[model samples]
Target: MPRIVLATHNPHKVEEFQAIVAEVRPDLDVVAYDGPEPVEDGVTFAANALIKARAAAAHTGLPALADDSGIAVDVLGGSPGVFSAYWAGHKKDSAANLELLLDQLSDVADPHRTAQFVSVIALVRSDGTEETIEGRWPGRLAVQPAGPGGFGYDPIFVPDGQPADAERTVGEWSAAEKNASSHRSRAFVALAPLLESL
Candidate 1:
């Protein structure tokens, strides 16, 4: 099978991407990148994704896929968009980031707690060609974190389309369910056709 480097050192991302990619391109192998991480100084998700993808492709001489994703609260004017991972500090503490976000929006009413999970996946071929695809999962933030299935803001994010009286956070969903309907999955789906050429 062909191999594609996924530009990330995070194990969670590696496993998640493997599951998502397997569904669309079972023949392709998604490998974790052990190369040096480039400075993601870009202000947007697409820019940061490309930076990583470019670095991975240069290091591995293979097609590289990198994604920059975050939770963007509508009430915050999309703040913490590119800063999602470092919301609390440069440590990239998931719990701290979640706490800080919830505290910031503590006063916001339920109807005003609208938010969206955004993901941008960039693909870089070894030959230097590059492309980006984006996906957004709209939802509202819960008052407190719930469930234990996901990382980062998943526990507090109640995805849309759930029964109003029985809404469930992404953290409450099974891995299979999340893999089928996450921002990453959506972005990867859009990039699937492009992968065929790799």
Candidate 2:
């Protein structure tokens, strides 16, 4: 099977993307990248994704896929977009980041707590073929964190499409459920056709 490198050192992302890709293109193999991390100086998600994808493609001499994703709170004016990981500090503590976000929106009403998970995936081939795809999962922020699954802001993000009275956060959903309808999944679905050429 042809192999593609996922431009990330994060194990969670590697597992997540592997699962997502397998559903679309079972013939392709996805591998985690072990290259030196590139500076994601880009302000937009697409720019950051391309930066990482380009670095991985150059380093491994293979086609690379990279995704830059974060929760964009509508009320906060989409703040912490690229800075989601380091929202609290430079340490990138998930708990701290989640706490800080919840605290910041404590006073906001439910109707105004709308947010969305945004993902931008970039595909870069060693031969200079490059493409970027995007996906956005609309939702609202819960008053407090719940469930024990998922990573990052999953615990507090109540995705749309659930029954209004019985909404469940991504953290409460199983890995299979998340992989089927997550922002990364949506973006990967968009990127599936491109993988056929490889």
For each candidate in the order shown, give its overall lDDT on alpha carbons.
0.95, 0.95
Q: Give all TM-scores, in the order shown.
A: 0.99, 0.99
Stretches of candidate 1 off by over 4 Å are: none
Instruction: State residue 175's C-alpha deviation in candidate 1, in Å.
Output: 0.8
For model 2 the TM-score comes to: 0.99
In candidate 2, what are the lDDT values of residues 45-164, reduced to their tens digit? 999999999999999999999999998999999977888999999998999999999999999999999999999999998798899999999999999999999999999999999997
> Alpha carbon lDDT of residue 130, candidate 2?
94
Candidate 2 clashes between residue pairs 3 or more apart in a chain or in different chains = none
What residue runs in model 2 are displaced by over 4 Å at the alpha carbon?
A: none
Return model 2's CA RMSD, one decimal: 0.6
In each prediction, how many residue pairs overlap at the backbone (N, C-alpha, C within less than 3 A)?
0, 0
